[model samples]
Target: MPDTEQLTTTTPNVQTDAPSLPNLEQESWQQLASAADSEADPFKTLVVATCTNTGAGARMVVLRQVDVIRKYLWFHTDARSEKVIQLEAFPTATLLFWDDKQQRQLRLVVETRLHTDDYVADDQWHTLGLGSRKIYLSERKPGSEQPAPYQGFPEQLGENLPTKEESEAGRKNFAVIECRTLSMEYLHLSRKGQTRALFQYEPESKQVWLAP
Candidate 1:
């Protein structure tokens, strides 16, 4: 249930503005930007679930970038990333984001493009801090078997990330994904109950507040 503030908005396109639409969009993007800049344990910061060939699915990845005006999102991966392989076979994916503090959930349906070339990959690689770049420097690719359950890198480097030169090995494996968001659904819980809305941005613009 929304606040008793009882503000209503009507947009020509959405058939209703309800003031809350812009409020929701603004707050949503602000929180999204914060999540993108998270400094702690960045893994699974934004999980994108994708269906690979044969109908298997997987999730858990970080959010690398966001273009609010353009409504596009990005994430980094290895050229050997399983998600990349899956996206190659099926370009559709769903991005799921939940913010506990706000009790908000965002679901985005997107079309994905993978870039493995040097120029594009280098652009993303240059932005990665030393700690993150170290993950890509492993001798074996991601998902590789461990001879003895290794720490994903040499023992001496345990919890100690490698230097720039050391991370160079990962440069060759860097991959960037561009996700054009097609639709965005938002859910927020309030004392009243729950408020749900759908914002569609592709093919045509659409917005709807549904009964929950």
Candidate 2:
């Protein structure tokens, strides 16, 4: 059998024939933008990690909005969730994304702000479908204890879609989290080789290949 060649010895931060950082940034935006309808975009559900007094707080959240020009991302959550409290105190977080098929990972550093009683929240809430709104209609606060397992929403509602008037009740608990991305780190893994790069957006915009 012939020995397979290894390509991992390539020097870091060398801008040669590889894809440019701008192209990576644009590709990330396109994936996030189309995630709602494209199952191929693993960014549809990314892991969000935040700082807490005890340690790190992490959870999986759906990607709601993407602003390519401004480098902002948005996701919706319950106003009373533990993460919301943590974010209120820390105001910063890391978003991690992985694409199994592409063998790629994206790490995004971001500054976050909560928008529960603002126009941003209202606009986002308005676009949510009944299925998504039902999550906010929980009778008890999130993470509450129960003798038996709870479905979050009222049992009577079952799987039925809530009426517009009924869904309005959820608006109070709905919250939109606005995230301003400061930097993005990209990594691609392959048996043949690996690629890494960093794209800085805040303070000043710059891109550089990074040591994998």
Candidate 3:
């Protein structure tokens, strides 16, 4: 009789290469630009944190546009929303992005400027499709109390999109939030090791690696 031994296989830890401190700024901006262009990109949605009279507030918003050279990020929101008020009161905010597939996170310190009735808002409004514009047609402002469950837009539409003329009504409610990036902190998680870096764009330009 012969004896047999059992064998087991172990999976290797995943390792992600970290960008050099010098190149981190460029790479991060490139990623953000791509996210702004691609709807499926996880980074297309981010947490925008703002200061309130009492404390702090945070909400998820879609990434509308990115100017890599200018280091500006844009997102659309209701002109009458609470966030718009908060941002107007305190223009500084923190924009946070996380990509699960890449195991990466980006925290951006930004100064916000609201554009409600300017060419900037008009340009961004024109880019919205009917589906995206539909919400702006709501008679009630965002976060308004409802008798029951009210869809943001008019209930009569009932899943139907508004025409260009009909959608125009929403233009007054649409607002563009322009975020000027002051600094960005990048963090990458890997089984092998973690990487963290900071890139400052305002006050003074600087890049540095930090302890992860």
Winning model by lDDT: 3
Q: Rank the candidates by lDDT, best first.
A: 3, 2, 1
TM-score of each: 0.83, 0.89, 0.91
Q: Name the regions of candidate 2 deviating beyond 4 angstroms.
A: 1-17, 36-40
Worst window of 10 by summed lDDT in candidate 2: 9-18
Across residues 1-212, which tens digit of lDDT does each residue of candidate 3 receive? 65577778998443356667778778889999999999899899999999999999999999999999899999999999999999999999999999999999999999999999999999999999999999999999788887898889998899899999999999999999999999999998877798888999889999988888
Give the poorly placed runs of model 3, Cα more than 4 Å off. 1-17
> How far out, in Å, is residue 24 in model 2?
2.1
Candidate 2 vs candidate 3: which has greater TM-score? 3
Higher-scoring candidate on lDDT, 2 or 3: 3
Q: Give stretches of model 1 more than 4 Å off.
A: 1-19, 40-44
Q: Which ten residues in a row have the lowest lDDT in candidate 1?
A: 11-20
Superposition TM-score, candidate 2 onto the true structure: 0.89
Q: What is the C-alpha lDDT of each candidate?
A: 0.78, 0.88, 0.93
